[model samples]
Target: MEQKVFAFLMFSGQADEAMKLYVSAFEDAGIVSAKYYPQSEPGAKPKVLHAIFSIKGQQVMCIDNQLSDSHPHAFTPALSLFVNCDSEAEINEVFAKLAEDGKVLMPLSPSPVSTLFGWLEDKYGVSWQLNLPAR
Candidate 1:
């Protein structure tokens, strides 16, 4: 059976911001659905409990983990979102938007396998690899 696999991003109270940034940065992207946590206490800030968003037709699930600080849920570069960009300009644009306020592991450069490739960790700690595939 063919299965639809979705990348799930677990954020430490940055799910909403990340979702907004992703939806705005990528073409043909938008939030599919989201559920928020109600303000349980006085002056408590509301947060995204769960959400689903698509970036360039790829569906991603995410949530804000309240117990993230104590849990070993830090995002690592081992499992990054590998983006196969359609063009050099597209890869550059996407990299620029996602790399803002983030750390660049590998700057955009041509490789033997790709004309342009780069890896970065976004502000919310999610890792991404942008690549321009051969036509």
Candidate 2:
């Protein structure tokens, strides 16, 4: 079986805001193809139900809190996006931008596999791991 990796982000009732922030981040980073959820039906709760955005050439799936059954822990840092970058410069740029107004779990620096690496939770509280492969 050929499996693919998709990052499904969970937000605490801020999916739309997070999606907007992410789209801005990716666009500022020069990435393309950012999309968001459709408008809800009448009396329906609006949500970022599904989206496909690229981050440094990687496809990522994003969504808002629409389902009632999603557990709180299911949206924790353990399930953050792992961004693989091409250069330290790119890594630093992306990480610093995403870290604004958010918490930094690990500062950008050399890791065993990447020249620059960091872990950050975006302003929306969705965690992400930015890494630049050593070249």
Q: CA shift at 38, candidate 1, in angstroms?
A: 0.4
List candidate 1 segments past 4 Å from native.
Answer: 1-3, 41-45
Task: Specify the highest-TM-score model's number.
Answer: 1
Which numbered prediction scores highest in lDDT against the true structure?
A: 1
Name the Cα RMSD for model 2: 4.4
Encode model 2's per-residue lDDT on 66-103: one tens digit a residue. Answer: 55455553457877888787666667777888899999
Alpha carbon deviation, residue 27, candidate 2 (Å):
5.5
Give the true-structure RMSD of model 1: 2.0
What's the distance in Å from true for residue 62, model 1? 0.2
- Judged by lDDT against the true structure, how good is candidate 2? 0.68
Our tally of clashes for model 2 stands at: 0
Against the correct fold, how does model 1 do in TM-score? 0.90
Please give, for residues 1-135, the per-residue lDDT of candidate 1 as tens digits. 432898988888779889999998888799999999987888765578999998777789999897877885889999999989888878899999999999999999988898899999998888999999755
